[model samples]
Target chain A: MTSDRLAPQRVPIALGDRSYEILIGSGLLSLDGAWAGLPASADALIVTNTTVAPLYGAALAERLQARHRRVLTVALPDGEVHKDWTTLNRIFDALLEAGCDRKTVLYALGGGVVGDMTGFAAACYMRGVPFVQLPTTLLAQVDSSVGGKTAINHPLGKNMIGAFYQPARVLCDLDLLSTLPRRELSAGLAEIIKYGPIADPAFLDWLEASLDDLLALDVAALSHAVRRSCEIKAWVVGQDEREAGLRAILNFGHTFGHAIEAGLGYGAWLHGEAVGCGMVLAAELSARLGLIDRALVDRLRALIARAGLPVQAPRLGIHRWLELMRVDKKAEGGEIRFVLLDGLGRATMRPAPDALVAEAIEAHTAPS
Target chain B: MTSDRLAPQRVPIALGDRSYEILIGSGLLSLDGAWAGLPASADALIVTNTTVAPLYGAALAERLQARHRRVLTVALPDGEVHKDWTTLNRIFDALLEAGCDRKTVLYALGGGVVGDMTGFAAACYMRGVPFVQLPTTLLAQVDSSVGGKTAINHPLGKNMIGAFYQPARVLCDLDLLSTLPRRELSAGLAEIIKYGPIADPAFLDWLEASLDDLLALDVAALSHAVRRSCEIKAWVVGQDEREAGLRAILNFGHTFGHAIEAGLGYGAWLHGEAVGCGMVLAAELSARLGLIDRALVDRLRALIARAGLPVQAPRLGIHRWLELMRVDKKAEGGEIRFVLLDGLGRATMRPAPDALVAEAIEAHTAPS
Candidate 1:
């Protein structure tokens, strides 16, 4: 066991009356002290999935059982595509059979899929049970774990059904990423890179320089990236946890990326893969609008390509893209809002014309 | 239409951190101004049940349409038994098909069942969307509407699955209750009587005295009961919205009542009816503990009986009662926490021994 001297830190997300904390650190899974911050009770259910159970479920259950008199674990099928109401109902069924109560705390262990499912389950279980996020994937650690966005993908649209439920604590154990596949690690980096253009320019520079070290899986590089990304997300989430205003900036590439994910079907493309390509397209769109220099857009695309991510959108055609983007959560009335870059680090939401979007799609699919 | 000036008043639930308002009155739903308080640029989905759609869904959609560019309504199956993940998914499916955005506001228009399902749906939709409660039942008006306890019943338990997502505005339309069935009206009174012993003693006495007028559906008496009950609930919820400490007092009869509801099966008895009987049993448990005068327990039973609710425990037998009670949300670490009265209007939670609980059940159900 690692030394327990390093204390976990909590980032307070201020939503006026709905503020909560995002706990950040490693080895948090073994800490009973972290559980104290949750709603005081002994009855809790740890909602994980098949992929995460072998790695962390037993240890987590043991820790919870040490502190709590009765601890139960419910493992579901693991996959991004499996994050749906039918899968969520399995959790409800377990909770009901266990006679779980309002005070019961649900621990979400695994990557984004498990965390998303657990948060959604907690949000609906008995109306709502307090849940803590034990994010085990890099994507979950740097991005999904911090924001209160919890949801399941609909067949028609990815993340179409969901809620903004802030977890009581977000336990990000960097050690968990040791087992993550290489593709997943790269996917998680896409979101880490996203925080740069959308919020912090300095972080972007750091990421650009540390790309090799991060890919090499250096602990310091990974920690710095994860911490900085969390800080940016924490600040944005704190300002607009419900995405009423500033939070929209976090979706810099998500509008286009979600369409790609939905267009190809949920599991066909990893979320971060689509996001990486979508960010490049969004930068191109920004350059066309004269919001950013074309050189900078090329540089952004080059970096994404160097990192082994796609820089061009899938060949869905412009019309399908328009239809898909229309169903985005960012769409208002009938108008679709796009979060475009104002500069290297600043992004703003604006409505774009159909002709420009069509041209961008044509360019994206025009043989690279 | 009644004067728009007579819109519902907001009662701010003043928790140090998660404080919010409970909007009470009539015609509040018809006002477009209320929608402005929600998150910007999001679509709006109104979730009502079959019973409430024809009554007020269109009016609500019309009001929201004035401020929102897109507003959609989904009507779910009515009744407590139907409030599950399956029905909840119907709203999720509709939102996805309609391309509802992340900022979409879900309006819950109905009684507790509608409010719970809509709130839970909102909590899960896009992770969560801002939701407002348009409570239309007497019971919901005073109790469920004010508290953010959103959930659906499981086959094994009454409110086995749920979340604690607060509504942006709880629009209590008293006029809608006029169409509620007489049985529902009577069932609601059981909760009305709950406020007295848990928090306010004078309120209990007032309820006992005004029982006839309230039962007769006198508008003034109904208004007073609804308003006062909300006040008590708002105060309790304000202190502990998640039932941490002060809110446990509000569950004076819920521990045993939930068991009865689950044992008899959900929808078999109106929630209020089971609660009424459970209150009698809780009072008896209090007497067994020598915590309260037996006469007061009998008085509590009489009041519940006069309100046309069952006061005697059903013949599910002691073993079944224990099994059901074990599943109560109040049970922590496998120990039953009973909210027993020290006196009429004063309650506290303590672990009751199963032997004593069995003895109390025998005392309450023995042929006498």
Candidate 2:
């Protein structure tokens, strides 16, 4: 008797001794085999948020219960802003109260907020516990859920506090995205578009052609996009798991993007939205430096616009942008490193002159 | 011209990919070349405590300034209870205000409290940044400094929040021990005694003979003890960087010791004080189970007593002990796994019978 259930794809992040796998696909959340890799007889803690609990908490409990004798769930307020120490303590309290052990596996079951917070909690719980990611948003599915970058944002900077903790398994269910709002969908597409330019030009061209289909919630288009993005992320992470060298390329538009996010106040702009606009600015910067033609920059901006994402920065005022960007992680000793594109698929980290960066910011923020 | 400075010993941890070196000796705090392995052009943030800043902070700052163009330091309150999110944010604030970037390196300059907090802060700063350990206390230099177990205490449990973040370099300066109080000296020796049973039997025998000399501040005896303990810890951490198996051996006395610390309230008992008493109880429990001869337990207790360490539990009451132990990381599904000695130089994890554990607790708390 053969079953028709699709097998989960496990993408191994090779950090040598510190390496782990990212388990991708739908319905894996309900599999006991997923918990088999964890310590035997260990207690399990499901960390979800208010928005995710109503949607999938019961089902997750049922799945974990089949393998583990005891299980507990803690749900926190859902939002990027809530991913701070205050919200993180709720998990600490629940684990301490429930007598959760070092071997306890913390299952993160939400978007980037839940995943990052859960990962940080796991990193700190008992000085670290076994944790698995059950990411439930399109943006998390394609990006945040794969890498080991777990953090809580500080008021001064985005993701200013966190750890490079690799999850034992990252269970990404594509079906969960069916409930995501339209704006979130567009925001997620920004990351999906990102993978193409930094790693695969062909993927970028395919994304441009299938932008409408993906926006319409076409399953095949979405799956392909998610798979390709994960593959690129896995390969990059495998080579530079700790963000040493090659990994900087993966942050193609993130330098400017993080600055934008911090300038707007976290949660004001979705991570992907900031990244989308940042990618356009990077392209313009690349053109100004004569690395890529100005026509290519227009093409990149047009694709971003067609996908319903902002191709320009919001009116944050240039001074605020410079102040925010100066604290960005990508900046080094007063020099801002921009991940500028060499062509459609290739990118490099270049030190942009302050005057040119200011000019790009001015152009992008101008009306129309 | 030949300088009179002695070269620091680099103890190599042998795990193939996750291998690291532990530098031991005095004056390592003044070596900027110690940070050569970290990413280039990275800004640095030094996380310390109030007590250590006045002692070694200026010297460390001068050395770091010679290496990195920008270096910032944040001094936190000294104590175990303050090793929480509130204190962690102080470092985050300095990093943000100093405009620290992702590649920033954090230097932990103090005792165990400062090292653990600094390593944890580095683990969370920008999702992760490289950190170096400049352990300035006998307890830190001999024990906490070598291992990567970084954490903060939760109200409900000690070390309930933390991470296993490794440092790029560990500089354990023996000269710093000159300033450590005599009470703290005995507290640090408890961890030194721990190394013998778990990994080195000869070391245990040697420690028993040299206990008085070590207490008398015999430099040769103390240096040998510190070096051996670091070698064992580094080996275990190297073998199981994530505590999969071999690394758990390092926690032989920690499972029970942590409970005692939390039961009495964090900071109420010095970590080594609790561990010294916990090891005696663990040996007794082992003897009760026929895992070791009664003479082994008696010898262990005698050695602890000679070192001026507690061999009995404080008056926390049995009910509180049970409650705190239940929340221990070694616990799984209400069954606590105690690390008991099989012999004078061997330890193993087993689920202790409640009756035996209760009896042991009763005996430890008896008036005598």
Candidate 3:
């Protein structure tokens, strides 16, 4: 609630009683306000990935200790490869072994992979328990952390198995992103850039102008980027929590992005990286469909490349790409549905002709 | 819609948009009305257990063919033992391999295990697809099928992992119960008897009078029993879909029932049998707490025994039972909450002293 320019920014996601606030600021993790109002529990389990555990697991657990009588931490193996039933079971096993009840609160303390698995574990553990999101990566902070879309990847598809379970709160501590690898930082930017073209043209302009500051982990720029991204996502999710319509627009690049992640095997490229590359191809398709002009398509592609995302998709072969996209959750009746840009700042879900889709893939496929 | 006394009866579960109807009658599976209004999908997957698949899988698939362009059937390993992540994953594999879209409809064509697993599969597949319940067992028709409580058993507890995803519709075809084995039939009767003490004293009187007719598979007796059970369950669930309060009453025997199943290793005893024994213990505990008289406890015990269910609880050791009940979803903050009968036709969730619970167990324990 602080209005100080340097204070943490709070963006509330309106989901009725399930509604929660996202706190974005530098070092918010150590602040009491960040932990306030979360569902109280006798036991709190911190579900984080191995990569982020050593860095902040203890610190996060320390803050939670003040709220919960007993605080436990389980560090899952790092990466998208482990986002499966096996990895998910580990969380369940920990909760059960510790005798954690439905009242136990789970804290997802890593990037998208950790957040997704933890959220899903919370959703299924004893038919769901409350959970909080402590997103440490840029992509998670801006996109995955805001929406209630929690899932683990199946062998056939990325995020093929999951639930629409919302977290109790999300704390996107900007200071945590200081440790993010250069590659992952750019990947996070890809999602930050996604919000601009699909929902806010002005935000897209802001991202383009502030990409450098974000890359440098500048606190103010990171705060604005994370807060604005959450606001846009929150607005869309509020309208369609189940993705029956408006919420699907938030997945503008995900259909293509998922195909790439699945086709290459998950963890080959980070999820954000895949989405970044996929956004380029999605823009190409939008241009070919005459939904958006070529100039806009090139503009999106240029921004994606400048953000250090690959503009060229891996050569998965045209048929494989089509086959993969058809299996994307967006597809209906076996027909692949793409979230195409109707114009700058507006998105729509529709099917493109296979020939045209193939052409778009061919236009952007990396050479053999 | 038919007014004929012999016609199918519909009990609509009022869960807003997620609301669906339970059609109970003779030969409901073959009737077009039962299949009508279900979400249309290009592909339909019939998930059944090996035992039920041979008897009803093809017939159910055939009925669904009229609605779906393609019909697929998967026969899982039979029994509660198979309701685990591995068996659940088989459903996901079938959907992914068939290239099923999010719009695909899954039909659960077996008993409680099949229905629970299928509903859970539908809930998780591509983040949920519509599923219809063709519950064949009496326990399933009256309890599991009516409420949307779908789950798979974990090694630590019964139904430890699951979701509260409702089915598109539930078909409790009374004719299917004709082939049900005597033990399972008895098991199913346990759930039907459950509705009486917790919600309707009159229904309990009717069950006591009609137990023989229900056991003999008298169409009229079975129809009335199944319909009343669904009505009571639907009423309870409609008010508390997430078991925040009233819905926990439906799990009257389940807390102790689950302990028996887990103690014996899931498949050693049928879920309903365990519940039957558990109800006797629950009633004993209720009597010990003076919530109900010894006469009422004996009345419920005698009915459960006459229905061919075990009234004597298994020797799991009192401490083990206490430990298992603490992990039950109803338990909060490590305190075990039992759904006890305050009086005939009234259920209340309250914590009882450990001494009383142990005494209740001691009173009902079978000779080792």
Best by DockQ: 2
Error of 3 at A96 (Å): 1.5
lDDT of 2 by residue, A228-247 (tens): 88889888877777777888
DockQ for every prediction shown: 0.56, 0.73, 0.69
Task: Write the number of the candidate with greater TM-score, choosing between 2 and 3.
Answer: 3
What docking grade does candidate 3 earn?
medium
Stretches > 4 Å off in candidate 2: A1-42, A253-269, A312-327, A352-368, B1-10, B16-18, B26-44, B62-65, B68-71, B197-201, B244-269, B284-298, B311-338, B350-368
- A1-368 in candidate 3: lDDT tens per residue? 12234788989888777888888897687777777778997999999988899999888888888899999999999977788989899999999888787788999999888999999999998888999998898888887776688899888766789898989988888888878899999988988899899999999988889888777778898899988988998888788877788888888889999999889986798888999888988889999999999999889998898899988889998889989888666776689989999999999889999999989988887667
lDDT of 1 by residue, A1-368 (tens): 23334566655666654466666555666666666656667688888889889988888888887666689898999886688768888888887777666678888888888888888777666556778888888889888767777877777766666676778777777667878888888889899899888888888788889999878766667777888888888888777666679988888888899999989987688989999989988988898888999887887888787777877788887788999999776787668899999988899999999888887667777563
Instruction: For candidate 3, write residues B221-291 as lDDT tens digits.
Output: 88889889888887887787787777789889889998898789867888899999989989999999999
Please list all clashing residue pairs in model 3, or write none if there are none: none
Give residue A150's error in model 3 in angstroms: 1.7
lDDT of 1 by residue, B1-368 (tens): 22334545556766543455666565556555555566554478888988889988888888777767888888998876688768878998898787666667888888888888888777767666678787888888887867678777666765666677777767666667768887888789999998888778898899889999877766557767887888888877777766668788888788888888888877788888888888988988899899999898888888899999988787788888898887676777678899999877788899888888888777777483
Every model's TM-score: 0.84, 0.86, 0.90
Backbone clashes for every candidate come to 28, 2, 0
- The list of candidate 3 runs beyond 4 A from truth reads A1-5, A253-271, A277-298, A312-338, A349-368, B1-5, B253-269, B312-338, B350-368
- CAPRI rating of model 2: medium
